[model samples]
Target: MRRRVPNEVGIAAVVVLVAIVLSVLSPNFRTIENAQVLLLNGAVIAFLALGQTFVLLTGGIDLSTGSNIALTGMIAALATSAGLPWYVAVIAAIAIGLVVGSLNGSLIAYLKLPPFIVTFATFGVAASIPLILTGASSVNVRDPFFAIIGRGALFGIPMPVVLVAVAAIVFSVVLRFTSTGVHIYAVGGNAETSRLAGVRSARVIVLAYALSGLCAAMGGLIVTSRLMVGYPSAGSGNELFYSIAAAVVGGVSLFGGIGSIGGALLGAMLIATVSNGMNVIGVESYWQPLVIGVIILVGVVLDTHRRRISLATLLSRFRGPREAAAAAPTS
Candidate 1:
């Protein structure tokens, strides 16, 4: 039997408490307009976190997510500006993501390069690609279909939020019921064991990075659509940290093989809530990063503690009756 951790519940509690506190402290925080802003902005982080979840589950990290977004956004924008159809531009963006992901995966999985080093190198290349392609300029997106994807609402709910929810549902189902998903967990849990069990760790790792890239590209498209422009430095490095933090905070293990897409969604929402609450309560913009950092520190500590407890519980459950009895206190 697998041992359970309380990280998910803890995160949910924190989110509820923060939302209640923010609502009490600032009337504006409870308004529909503010809610819309929070969800719409949060959708991008949620998408990025979902991708990060996949990589982290495979015992790896992708530092190039922000760069992937920049490059892919520029690709989409440039394609559209060149008289290509909007769908073609969208496909171009995803293709860029897949190609970049493949590069990261191939080097790490096949070449036996360290994930951090490979992704870090790719991060520089991917980030600079947009600058080189556009000479560091922004491109406006004017296609009505593409524009609506970013700005439209369904039944009064923002499209980005809806899209994110749909994606989350699909991913959750895939991770829970599919053979590939099982392979992902197996690979992350124990690569040697998984290989002995006939799982192809290299292919799975590559696919995970590819999915990460695809998600990054989607996030980039949403951001571009919102602003209606593809800025060379659109995502910046901040998003990379946010996506990782969200995955970690939402119960995704940094050590790998233990997380859910639903948890990642909650983590993303918590991040968005914190940022929104701080703004509504009049915190200085510059101080927001400090607040986020503190939250991440607390989350990491809690996760470590949870893992320890889970380990202890599992060990106790496996001990023989006499051994367990001998170890127990006799008050």
Candidate 2:
């Protein structure tokens, strides 16, 4: 039998190939400083992608993550301006994310609502809250310590990058080794079957969305800390798009129950690298989205193809036994 290569290996190779091409095309793209900047810029998307992975694993999507970032950041800024300690503000922001995620999960899991509708409604609501609360104005963050979360470095790596790395590691372990993680995969693979097998599908779904919300909150913190302000329009741009694109490109199946945190991170890095390289090479800003859209379409097509092939292979394996038994003179 021929060995099949992992999806991650293929994506990683593509990332390296793209990086090499960019390095050759643009002298500045090869610099260490540029590399650090690229990683830093990609950190927020990475966080969102990580969170999306959990939700996606359960055959669900969270469109509210980008809006969650805006809402959470605004909340943190407002809390800071109202004389709350930085840590307190952080907690407040994270708490809001949990609440929103829980709400989304509850509606989908208990009410049997579609994940798309629930999260899309959440997206609108979360996005609107920041604008309404701040009256469409940016809230300034006066706490200097709050900046550390975004700007501080550990062992020469950017703080955001370090934080994402830590998060990826922790989550990777949990998904691979924990019962909750197994439940998440089972739920995503087949919710009805999992439920019949005694898995708490509803609870698993809720936890997935909650984890996604937590990740969005972390992204919000980094963005707010770096800017030292809570702009009501924050995360209203390409963040949500880029996050989904990154996850898809990283081998996460849109249908659910497939993908890894490591692959998602690689996908994030590829996106960041492409964006930065384009900027360095003077590609028009308007064209960047076009390129990313193409990437997304390709990822989706590939995912579908892989699924079909796997399904066919499984069917053939099952048929092999039946066909051989029938041909054995009814033995």
Off by over 4 Å in 2: 1-3
Q: For candidate 2, lDDT tens digit of each residue in 1-331?
A: 9997888998899999999999999999999888878887899999999999999999999999999999999999999999999999999999999999889988999999999999999999999999999899999997889998999988878899999999999999999999988998999888889999999998999999999999999999999999999998889877888888899999999999999999999999888889999998889999988989998899999989989999999999999999998889842
- Each candidate: what lDDT? 0.89, 0.93
Residue pairs of candidate 1 with colliding backbone atoms: none
Span of ten consecutive residues with least summed lDDT in model 1: 141-150
Find the candidate with the highest lDDT and give its number. Answer: 2
lDDT of 1 by residue, 1-331 (tens): 9975655787899899989999999999999999988998899899999999999999999999998888888888888889898889889999999999989999999999999999999999999989998888899876767876679889988888888989899888889999999999988888999999999999999999999998999998898878778989988846887898899999888777889998899999999998888888999888877877886787678778877988898887788676978999999
RMSD of 2: 1.2
